[model samples]
Target: MVPHQCLGSVWSRRNRPGNEHVAPTVRATIAQFNVVASCIITTCLGDPSMTAQDRAVVVGHWIRVAKACQILGNYSSLRAILEALQSVSIHCLQRTWDNVSRKSF
Candidate 1:
């Protein structure tokens, strides 16, 4: 999905009310999850004017971060990073992808 659409869906769910049955901790956890996911997508695609090489560098940085998250057993952040990288907005940047090093993948 496109980054903006994904973020909008998450935002809607996060703000939806009338779920008193759900524990406060659970609600907070879900909110945190959504926020992390949204942030990851935004950070990856927020700057439209960035050069292809700069975008590639950002992509590489995220890849390394995902690897660290995996090693540390931070599945939530890892999933968010993966989703952001795979999102249509970032995936369609052919020039950026071309500039990304093989090691990043």
Candidate 2:
């Protein structure tokens, strides 16, 4: 998602109660799960062309997003993000994961 558009839209939706411009809670949860899963698969395994260093960078970005979700009290997104991080596909990349700092785990 584009940074300004997605975040700006979510912020705007927070002000209006009746308008259905955004997704409902369940749909949002499913969407978040799908997004995180896609990120995990693509970043960790899908791109044979992408360097391990590049994938690690993408994973780090997701970790930051997860932390932001936690701080915002968005547990569903946080849970989905965490599950993506914990997936076996990501874990299978030992070299990529080794680049992650010990404190991050």
Candidate 3:
């Protein structure tokens, strides 16, 4: 038998009826994270005139999104967004980040 079928059979045996809701919740959470990740990367990379303050604001917004992902138990999205933020940091204006509050970091 195929591995997929084997796994499904095992999963079905252990699964409860009401747990069917998990798939849709997971799908929606992933979709939301995808959009958020796209927006964060685009906003940071596309704008050359972005000030340090601007960068801090962007990072702050992403931090909030990451927190939401954590609360929702969506590790995939949280990791993706955090990585994207780290990737974009190399391009960020240093002086602006210095001025930002520590809590945002």
Tell me each candidate's TM-score.
0.73, 0.62, 0.56
Across residues 24-58, which tens digit of lDDT does each residue of candidate 2 receive?
55346567778867766666667788777877877
* Alpha-carbon lDDT, every model: 0.77, 0.72, 0.69
Best prediction by lDDT: 1
Per-residue lDDT over 1-105 for candidate 3, one digit per residue giving the tens place of the 0 to 100 score:
234434555546435776654445444655776786777788765688887778777777778888998999978788878877766554455775576668866
What TM-score would candidate 2 get against the native?
A: 0.62
Between candidates 2 and 3, which one is better according to TM-score? 2
User: Which is the leading candidate under TM-score?
Assistant: 1
What lDDT does model 3 reach? 0.69
lDDT-best of 1 and 2: 1
lDDT score, candidate 2, position 21: 48
| Residue 15's lDDT in candidate 1 | 44
- Shift in Å, residue 43, candidate 2: 3.7
**RMSD to truth, every model:** 8.1, 9.5, 8.6
Which pairs clash (backbone N, Cα, C closer than 3 Å) in model 2? none
TM-score of 3: 0.56
Model 2 RMSD to the real structure?
Answer: 9.5
TM-score of 1: 0.73
Off by over 4 Å in 3: 1-38, 88-93
